[model samples]
Target: MNIYLTRHGQTEWNTQGRLQGWQNSPLTEKGRKDAKLLGERLSKIPLDIIYSSSSQRALDTAKIIKGNRNIETIIDDNLREINMGPWEGRILEEIEKENPVEYFNYWNAPHLYVPLKGGEYFEDVQKRSVAVIDKIIKEGKYKNVLVVTHGITLKNILNYYDNKAMENLWDTPFIQGTSLSKIEVRDEGIHVPFFGDTSHLE
Candidate 1:
């Protein structure tokens, strides 16, 4: 199966540096344009199915990409961004100021970081995200799919296929909004031909 993964476009919260986990936000003007551009790029490809997170930001992005196409987007909760719990809606800078230790742990040592009150565990995010894709693949259908999701969720799935440690989750470069990544899954294993490519927005 071939999966073309993309993070949802920029949102108001994104511009404000807010932690947008599980919280909904409207896409900014630039977000819409980027989505449109991505849509143009994907429109040239042969898409058999489309999947998007339940978040409005993701749904909107998917819709923009779908445009007038007859494709029906399958919305799934498993594709939703990580639940930030108490951290939702709060500016990331403020979180760093109020709880430097926890914030630092979340970035540098995700495995050791404690989940915020009512927040999701990193392990859970990775497991659920992987399970969703596995289920789709096991169904033996939907060979080519476009998955519109969030940065954290997309990162978790990418990391899983890369065989990277959860602790290094934030060590690499940030996953840009509206970026693209392609993964191919076969009986042998998973392979990432490219990851987090945002050249389309350039």
Candidate 2:
């Protein structure tokens, strides 16, 4: 079995640098355009199944790429982004630039960091992500699986593979729009990602 990870296109929050968390939002105009481009790119590639986060942006991108393929795109809530609580819909820079201490603390010490009101801890996101991956592997229903999810969720999956920490995990680069990352999944082992490949977008 193989896993291909892709993040959804840009959203208004993406432009505003807001923490989207559990908030529902759609893709922007350019994001939809990019989704079409992504669809064109994937149309030729054979995908047995497509799994996406229930969030509109992620599901929308999946639909665009799946297009007429009519591939079953499962809305896996487990693949959704981390719930940011009070930070949801708030600009990232506003929090980082103004709440420097809290931001820095969360960045450096996520294991010790507590979630804000209605927020989620890194551990919570991590556990759920791991569970979803396990379910996919156990199903063994398809040879190649495409996963469209959020930036943080993608990185968290990578962290699990690389045995890295939360802060270092975010440092990993994931470009916007039709990003494709490859990960090798052997018959009986863990997945190891090769990092995002934007060559298709290029």
Candidate 3:
């Protein structure tokens, strides 16, 4: 199976440097354009199905990518961004000023970070996101699958495929908005050809 993963296009919150979490903002004009460009790149690729986060940004991106394709698109709640709870829709700079240590841990030391009231742990996010991918793999019907999700959620998913420790979760190759990652699973084993690719946008 060939799994194509992409983060939702840039949104208003994205440009504002605010945390989106479960909260949402409409996609910026650039976001829509990027999605359209990606659709053009994938036009010739035969996609069996598309799984997208319930978030509007992700769903919109999935629909844009789907374009005129007849493939079925399914919304999966498990694909949603990590529940940021109180931090949702908050500016990152403000969060850092108020909760310096925790904010630092969130980015520099993920494993040591703890969620605020109603927020989610990185471990929980990974479990839920991986569960969805496993369910898709078990279905065994799709040869080419497209998954549109949030930044943190996609990071967790890619971390699982890379088998990296939680401490190294924020490694290099940042997951840019609408960047594409490809993974191939075969009877022999799993292989990641490339990740965080944005050539389509260029």
Each candidate's root-mean-square deviation in Å?
A: 1.2, 2.0, 0.8
> Per-residue lDDT of 49-86 in model 1, one digit per residue for the tens?
89899999999999998898888789999999999899
Positional deviation of residue 69's Cα in model 2 after best superposition, in angstroms: 0.1
lDDT of each: 0.89, 0.79, 0.91
lDDT of 2 by residue, 3-72 (tens): 8888898898788777788996678998887778777877776889998999988998888878888688
lDDT of 3 by residue, 1-202 (tens): 9999999999999999999999999999999999998889888789999999999999999999899889899999999999988898999999999989889999999999998999999999999999999988888889999999988888888888878888988985789888999878899877678888999887
lDDT of 2: 0.79
Which runs in model 2 stand beyond 4 Å of their true positions? none
Q: What is the lDDT of residue 108 in candidate 3?
A: 96
The model with the greater TM-score, 2 or 3, is 3
Rank all candidate structures by their TM-score, best first, as comma-separated numbers. 3, 1, 2
Clashes of 2: 0
TM-score of each: 0.96, 0.89, 0.98
lDDT order, best first, reads 3, 1, 2
CA lDDT for candidate 3: 0.91
**Top-lDDT candidate index:** 3
